[model samples]
Target chain A: MIQTVYIIGIGLIGGSLAKDIKKSRPDITIHGIDTSAQHLNEALELGIIDEKTTVEAIDKADLIILSTPVDAAVKLLPMLLDRVSDFGLVVDVGSTKSEICKVANAHAKRRNFLAMHPIAGTEFSGPKAAVANLFQQKTNIVCEIEKTAFKLQEKALNLFASLGMRMRYMHPESHDKHIAYMSHLSHISAFMLGKTVIEKEKNERDIFDMAGSGFESTVRLAKSSPAMWTPIFKQNKDNVIETLQEYISNLTHFKTLLESDDFEGVYKEMDETNYIKQILNGIQ
Target chain B: MIQTVYIIGIGLIGGSLAKDIKKSRPDITIHGIDTSAQHLNEALELGIIDEKTTVEAIDKADLIILSTPVDAAVKLLPMLLDRVSDFGLVVDVGSTKSEICKVANAHAKRRNFLAMHPIAGTEFSGPKAAVANLFQQKTNIVCEIEKTAFKLQEKALNLFASLGMRMRYMHPESHDKHIAYMSHLSHISAFMLGKTVIEKEKNERDIFDMAGSGFESTVRLAKSSPAMWTPIFKQNKDNVIETLQEYISNLTHFKTLLESDDFEGVYKEMDETNYIKQILNGIQ
Candidate 1:
């Protein structure tokens, strides 16, 4: 019975979801909203959405997807919950979940909102970067699922499954904490690595040619859009700080091992971390 | 003029070179040597070499590839130089350049050795990980090329070109310093990032499901062989320490930005680092 969908933020995540949703339920009419009129136009040209509309027209939709940055999502969730139809569901696909879930919990129509953090993305962004199968077999972490109306939750879960997502239920604060280690720290590590190399390469431009596939893979996340990531860090500041401290501590210990001529300790450190291969084997 | 080739170490780099060299120069006899007898046997069984021979008999080889770990290479280069035929060319493909080059520079047969480091490899290692054309379009950094005899250098250069390598001439010290930022720091960052996330996952084993392609890419190098990487970090300690200090400083600054709610600063940091896309586009 989910016949109409209104998607706010016609960027990579929203536009990609629109593509998959359209394929799964072709009869559903889709509307897209964004601060950039150009993105809405791009989504329409890409056939990711059927029409372009503002937030005011969302009430007529069966689903409202708020895929903006976490800060924007935080401000819009309460307003979206207020304007959503009795049968309509509101979902926010922000990176950090706790703040938005807290805001929604305080709203009168809290049961209409579902806080989600779908851990699927490439370094690329924008409507044009949207692809149909981006979410295929990707994990969709659903936070505060109990706060949503049971029927709306069922519809959301079914829609996600139809789009080929593996759904995992999580509470908001815990979701933020775990993600700070898994996802946020990775982005920061890549950004800082890129910054370090870029700073060095400025003086020795020839060093650029020396970077192989290893450097490229490690720094690929550094190419992600800052507009989307800055707010994620701002929202999950404490957890991010904690992860950074741990990462820096590990690096400092590595330096100490190197300084002390302890190749065995260095080897042991890397040997233990090799377990990540197993953990990530379950993923990509 | 090259008929017999001796590839010491007989692991990933040595075995891979053996594959490409065999394809290019079908008449040459490839002899494999390794500290691990199993690796030498694996190389022989895989057809990466025509024979598994002892290093004492390297006098018959026209080209001797010292592809062992840095510590082993440092110890063996002088002895190999002592035993090599007058026309034989000894090339060490260790990751660090300065230490091996320094050791080779003092040898009586310095004119018979070429210091080389091919900046190409996957995270996988061992003779079994060897693949044909692995060095295709890869950068091979040659240090102290002038120290090798002109005829031997010509043979090695032409042989390398035949295997589809692009050779860049660099001083050993400069190569180590730049590689510290470009390549060594990447491995350390990936290993430490993996360590940080793995430590967190021990408490909540379910967090492994939350990892995405981004985490996978950033942590990919953590799976690299510690036996190989330990000697690399040991040989390039000072440069690696300097690069780590700079990287840690950058991560700390990012944390400070998050602490003070400076979303704008965070955006600028990532936005600036996003230039890595263009830099990396030249590579991979």
Candidate 2:
């Protein structure tokens, strides 16, 4: 029964959600807000939003979605909650939720806000990269759902359900820790792999010719936007650092095993890790 | 014009080659050989080979392909050459070439053997994983091609061409060095990532719920067969170790930057690595 939706940061996640909302609830008008005027114009032209508006104009919106970078969301969430009408629901889709949730914890209108992390995205960015159904069957982790009003929680849940997302709930702290290992660490690994290979293979042609699908897949996330990720690494710095330490320790141990010519040890390690196949199948 | 072809180690790579060869040249008779009776029987039942034969029975084959693990290929290449007629060609599809090529370098019939590494494969293994057109438009690196007889080289080249492969030449040493960065290091990185994440995330359901396509792609190669990769790591030990050191160093540097709150440094590193998008596009 929402009449108006205001999506801040009209980039990939926000733009995609707008596309889905427009398709499922055509009666609801979508307003887009972005720091980049170009992105807002592009979203309007692409029909991703019905109009462009600012924070002051969103006071009348029944639903306000903050899809900006994690750092921006940390600053914007409390402010957005202050401006929202009593019946208006505010949600922030930031990758790291602990800091944002902590910032808004003692706010007078805390129940108006929900923190969510949608586990969906491509390496591509910008409004042009957005597509319908990006969240189809994808996991959407809602942190601190208890802090939100029950009616607003049901409204957000229904919207995500309409978009075909599977919902899971966690505390902001647990969500950050688990995601630091599963999601953020994977991006760092891929970026480092890309840097190592690019630095070693001075002859780029050689990388193109010799590299196969394995290299391509392992390094795919290296292409993600710096603007989006830098803020994420900053917000989730402690968990990310801890995970990187463990990952580096593991890599160093593997190097020692290889250096010592313990072929049997290396073989057994890979054989054990192959169980990831079964785990990955569950995600699919 | 190959009247009969014998493929040793009838597993993923060999079985795939047999499938492509049969499609391109239906008149060519395909024979498969393997130390494992189960593999040989499966290859025959799947029609990946017209017959299952012993090494002794390959004496009359117009072409003999050794598609075994690197260690096995090193042992089989020299012996397979001794049994081939002067008109017959012997080639290996092993991942590492320097050791295998060096082992066969002084054989009397060295001119009859060619060392090849097709830059292809999936995480899956065995004959059932084989599929047609696996090598179509894929790069085939032929090491020590100059050591083979010109007529035999033409025969091998034409056969690979028939299967729609694009050919490239490199000395075994250069091939090993380049592939250590582009190929071998990628596998180790993926395997270690999988190991690290698996160790930290004891609850597999948490990983399943949080992991997205990025995690799936980054860890894909961890599922590769250990029997195939262990020898690869052992044979290219020095180069693999060197690459591992550089990779670890780069990762450590990234961690240091993160610890120092050098957000700009971390941002620039990922931005530079984003050039991998162009490099990966070339691969596709």
Candidate 3:
């Protein structure tokens, strides 16, 4: 029964959602709102949304998705809670969950807010990087559904299903912790790996020459936007740290086996971690 | 001036090298030697090499390249050295260096051997993965050059140069230590990250849903062959352990900041790591 949808921060995730939803639901009015007028203009020209709206312009919409960065999402949630229509549902697609979820939890419209994080993105960002099928076969995490009204959660569920994403409900704390290990730590490792290699190789040509798919895979995060990631690490700091420690410990153990010429032990350890293959079997 | 060259292993690295060398020097006869007849047969069919040869068949070649897994390279080098012509040159493209260099150094034909590692590979392996442009503009690391005879090193210099690779020289020990940090540890971190997520997510559909580009970049190495990587971890265990420890320590420090609600410290730490952006400025 949702008719009008407003998307804030029309960057990669938001813009792509706009594009896909527009492509599928021809009758639903899609309104794009962003601090960047240029992004809004681009989204409009691309027909990603029906039109661009100011924060105040789309106050009547049934659903408002805050697809901004983590810090921005936290900062803007209280204000939107103040102005959102009685039946309107507000969702966020930020990477970090705990802070934003907590910010909206105490609101009078707390039952009207649904905390959402759709896990789909590319190395590239912005409206230009947005694509029609970005969310297809991806996972969407909806944190603390108990805080939202059952009807609002139901509305959010329909939105995710329409976009072809499977949904998981988690506590905000748990979501941040799991993601820190599974996502944020990876970024730090990649950035550090890129930094380490670039330091040793000195000449970019050496990295260009020596870096194969291994280095490329490990360092791909180096190309990620500093603006997006810095806030994520800040928001999910504890979890990110814990996951990083575990990862580093595993690696240190691996090194000790190699140093001692313990081929049998080293091979067995990797073979065990190779159980990761079984784990990846589940990945789409 | 190298007219006839032999390539052992006939997998991605060896086959790709043969194809590129043939493209660059049509008159140079390329001989392929692999323990797997299927691979040797495929190499010929793909025109990756000009002809298939056996151990004795390639004995008289001017140059022999051992492009096999680290385990296989260790086993094959001693045998190849026994048959190498007094004036012939031999090189290896194994992932690990120090052990391979040590095994070859005490051989009577030690002076004829050049311990080399071309820092390039895709996730895919074998002849099918072989592509002609693999080594172009890549790095070819020649280790323990002082152990190589002057004449043989000259030929190695020419061969790597012919492949359009920039050359870096290091003692084999140094190469292993540095590479453990740069290359080996990255794979372990990626594999474990993939495992950890897979373990918790349980549902592949959930992982696929939640996995953004960050997860993909961090887990891409999970697609790599366990056969190829097992020996590498075994060989470079010492340095990998050290690097892993340092990495873990950093993570723990960051985690402590998070637990203490030190948002300022967390933000500042991530900001410092962002300096990696400058280091990677020229890497394309």
**What are the per-model C-alpha RMSD values against the true structure?**
1.4, 1.1, 4.2
> Which candidate leads the pack in TM-score?
2
Q: Cα deviation in Å at residue B192, candidate 3?
A: 3.4
What are the per-residue Cα lDDT tens digits for candidate 2 across B245-266? 9999999999999999999999
Sorted on TM-score, best first, the list reads 2, 1, 3
Residues A112-167, model 1: lDDT tens digits: 99988888989999999898899988899998788889999999889989988999
- Span of ten consecutive residues with least summed lDDT in model 1 chain A: A275-284
**Across residues A1-284, which tens digit of lDDT does each residue of candidate 3 receive?**
78899999988999898888777777889998988888889889988888878888657888898988888999999999889988898988998999997899778889889987888887667888789888887778888888888887887688678888878888888788767766787777776665555545555344343445576677777667667877887777667766766666666665566667777775565555555545455564
Using DockQ as the yardstick, the better of models 1 and 3 is 1
Listed in order, the DockQ scores are: 0.87, 0.85, 0.36
lDDT of 3 by residue, B59-160 (tens): 689889888788888988888899999888888888889999889987988998998888877766889988877877777788888888897788768867
lDDT of 2 at B160: 93
* All candidates in order of lDDT, best leading: 1, 2, 3
User: What TM-score does candidate 2 get on C-alpha atoms?
Assistant: 0.98
Better of 2 and 3 by lDDT: 2
lDDT of 2: 0.90
Stretches > 4 Å off in candidate 2: none
Q: Against the hidden reference, what TM-scores do the models get?
A: 0.98, 0.98, 0.82
Model 2, span A28-135: residue lDDT tens: 999999999999999999999999999998789999999988888888877888899998998888889999999889789998888898999988888999999999
